[model samples]
Target: MARPSEGAARGKPRKIVLVTGGGGGIGRAAAQALGTGGRHVVITDIDASAACETRRLVTASGGTADIVEANLEIAEETANVVEHAAAKGMLAGVVHCAAVFPQRTFARATITDFDQVMGLNFRAAFLLAKAAVPVMEVKGGALVLLTSGAVRLEGADTPFQRPFALYGASKAALDRWALGVAPELRDRGIALHTLTPGAFVETPGTRRIDRRAIPSLPIVPARQVGEAIAWLARNPRMSLAGRRLDATAFGHTWGPG
Candidate 1:
C-alpha cells in the first residue's frame, strides 16, 4: 500500500483517516467531522455495537465511515488496526482516542488494574505510533491522542480532590509519549497532538459519579470536546505537535460559545 506522501505527489486534501475508539464521545465526533469534511473515516472500537452505531450515525449524517472491532488493550489487536489501514493504501491520518481509566486508591488498586489502564492509555499510544510511522512517513499526516484533565488537575491544590492517582499517572505517561514521538515524527513527516478533556463528561461512566464531586463539571460539553479533537485532527499546523490543549483553550478557539 502506498503512503499519502508517495501517492499525493503534491499538496492536496487528505482522503482517508483512521480513528481508534471511534464508537463514542470524542472519537465518534472526530470521525463524523472528518467524514463530513469529505474524508473516508475508518472507525474502530472495543465495543462492536458502539462501532456499528457510530457508523450508522455517520451514514445518517451524510458522512462516510467503516467500523472495525478491536480491543486496543491487546498489543496484537493494536498492530492489526494499523496494518489493516495501511493495506488500504494512502492512510492520511490516525486518531488514537481509546483509553481506560481505572480510578482507585494506591492501597486498593491492584497491579492488574494499573497495568490495564497503562496498557490501554499509554502503551497503545506507543504501539500505534510505531505501527503508523511507516504509512505516515511517506506522506505527512496528523496524529491525535486523547489525554485527560485528570493529569493536569490531579494535584492536591486543585479544586477537585479526587483519588485519581492511577488515572493521572497514566495520562502523564501519555504526555511524555507524545513529546517523545514529536522529533521522530518530524523526521518522518508526521505530527503528534494531544487533547486533554477536563473533568468528567456526561458519558455513561461519568454519569455514575456524583456530579458535585467533579469540580468544573461539564465546563465543556462532550460535543465541544469532540470538536476540539476534530480541529486538532484536521489542522495542518506543525507547531501543534508535542503540545497539549486543555478544554478551555481548545473551546475558546473552536467552540459554539
Candidate 2:
C-alpha cells in the first residue's frame, strides 16, 4: 500500500486518517466515512472490542481499516497512538472524538469529577496536537476536533441548565483552544477546524444523560457529521479551516470519496 502523501503527491487518491475514540458514535462513523478504498483508517479507542468492531465494519464496507487499542487520557499514550499510525503511513488527518461528559451539576459533582472531565475532554486535545503537529508538518494534514453546541448556547439560567456546567465548561475550553491554534496550523499547511453536531446524537454518552428533565433538543444523525468530517479530511487545505462548522450547515451532501 502506498503512503498517503506519496500517492497524493502523485495525484492518486490516498490518505491515512486516524480516528480516536473509534469505539462508537461519531468516532466510529468518521472511521467508516474516511475508509475509502484509497484511504487507510486507523481506529483507536480505550474500548478494544469496539475499536475492533469499527475496523470490521469499515473493512466490510470495502474500505481499508486497522485497529489499535489506546487510552488517550494518558498524555504519553496519545503520542504513542499517533506514532503507531505514522509508522505505517504519512498521516493525512485526525478526527478526535474522545471525550467525557459527566452530566453533573456543580452542586452534585466533586473536584475530582471536574479534574477527570477536564483531563480527557480538554487536556487530551492539547497533548494530541503537540504530538501530531510535528508529523503533519512533514506533509500537511487536517485536525478535526469535536466541539459541542452546548458550549455555544449560554446565558439561560434554569433548573435544568445546571446539569451541564461540567460538560459545557470542558467543551468551551476546547473551542477556545481550537481558535487559538488555527493560525499556527495554517503556517505548516495543516488545516485546523472544529466540528459540532449542532444537535443531540443519541450515543453511548447521551444515552447516559438523564433525559427526562433535560428537555428535548434537536438531533442530527451521526452519519451526517461523520461524512462531513471525512469531507474535511479529504479536501484538507481546500476545505474551510479555522472555522467551527455545525453539522446542519456542513454535512448535507458529501458521500465518502
lDDT (Cα atoms) of all candidates against the true structure: 0.73, 0.80
Count of steric clashes across candidates, in order:
1, 0
**How many backbone collisions does model 1 have?**
1
lDDT string for model 2 (1-257, tens) is 42243275587545688888888999888888888535788899999998889888887776777888887878788899899888767788888899887767667899999988888888888888888889887879898899887685664355555677887889888989988989888888889988888888888767877767657678788888887888777647534678888877773432233
Supply candidate 1's per-residue lDDT for 82: 86
Q: Which run of 10 residues does model 2 get worst, by summed lDDT?
A: 248-257
TM-score of 1: 0.86
Model 1 — which ten-residue stretch has the worst lDDT? 1-10
Q: What is the TM-score of each predicted model, taking all chains together? A: 0.86, 0.90
Best model per TM-score: 2
Q: Tell me the TM-score of model 2.
A: 0.90
